[model samples]
Target: MHKIKRDDLVKVIAGKDRNKQGKVLNIDAKNNKVTVEGVNMITKHVKPSAGNQQGGIVQKEAAFDISNVMLVVNGTATRVGFEVKDGKKVRVAKATGKVID
Candidate 1:
């Protein structure tokens, strides 16, 4: 399983959005990238289409390298670690040593 997953709260540790925190909207595991809500926003100009008659410049979140972000645990950014719990491997927060589920 990936250390970061969809709907996870993450903090951008690198790039233009450094230090900014947002919820993960999607994860492109194959590309090692993630799209976070309200982060790495980009503008796309779209022509009018049947789906969107008023298509125009739209601001949306762009995917960023997964390495650029860290999981937020207990309100702080922290590295993830794996541990054996109840005979199962589980994620843990390095900063607080708490189970991350």
Candidate 2:
């Protein structure tokens, strides 16, 4: 399993949006990138298309290097750890040593 999953609360630890927290929207495991809501906003100019009647400059979230984000646990950013519990691997918060369910 990946350390960061969809809907997980994460905080950008690097780049222009450093320290900004947002929910994880998508994960690109092959590229090691993740898209977070309200982070890495980029404007794109689009021509009018059949699907989109009014296509102009639109703002959207862009994927960032997963290494640049840290998972948020208990309202704080923490490193992820793994341990076996009940014969199954489970995620743990390094900072608090608590199981992340």
Cα error, residue 10 of model 1, in Å, equals 0.3
The lDDT leader among the candidates is 2
- C-alpha RMSD values across all candidates: 0.7, 0.6
TM-score of each: 0.96, 0.97
Mind giving the per-residue lDDT tens digits that candidate 2 earns over 34-85?
9999999999999999999899999999998999999999999999999999
lDDT of 1 by residue, 26-65 (tens): 9998999899999999999999999999999999999989
lDDT of 1: 0.94
Cα TM-score of candidate 2:
0.97
Model 1 weakest lDDT span, ten residues long: 1-10
Cα error of candidate 1 at position 11, Å: 0.4
- Cα miss at 101, model 1 (Å)? 1.1
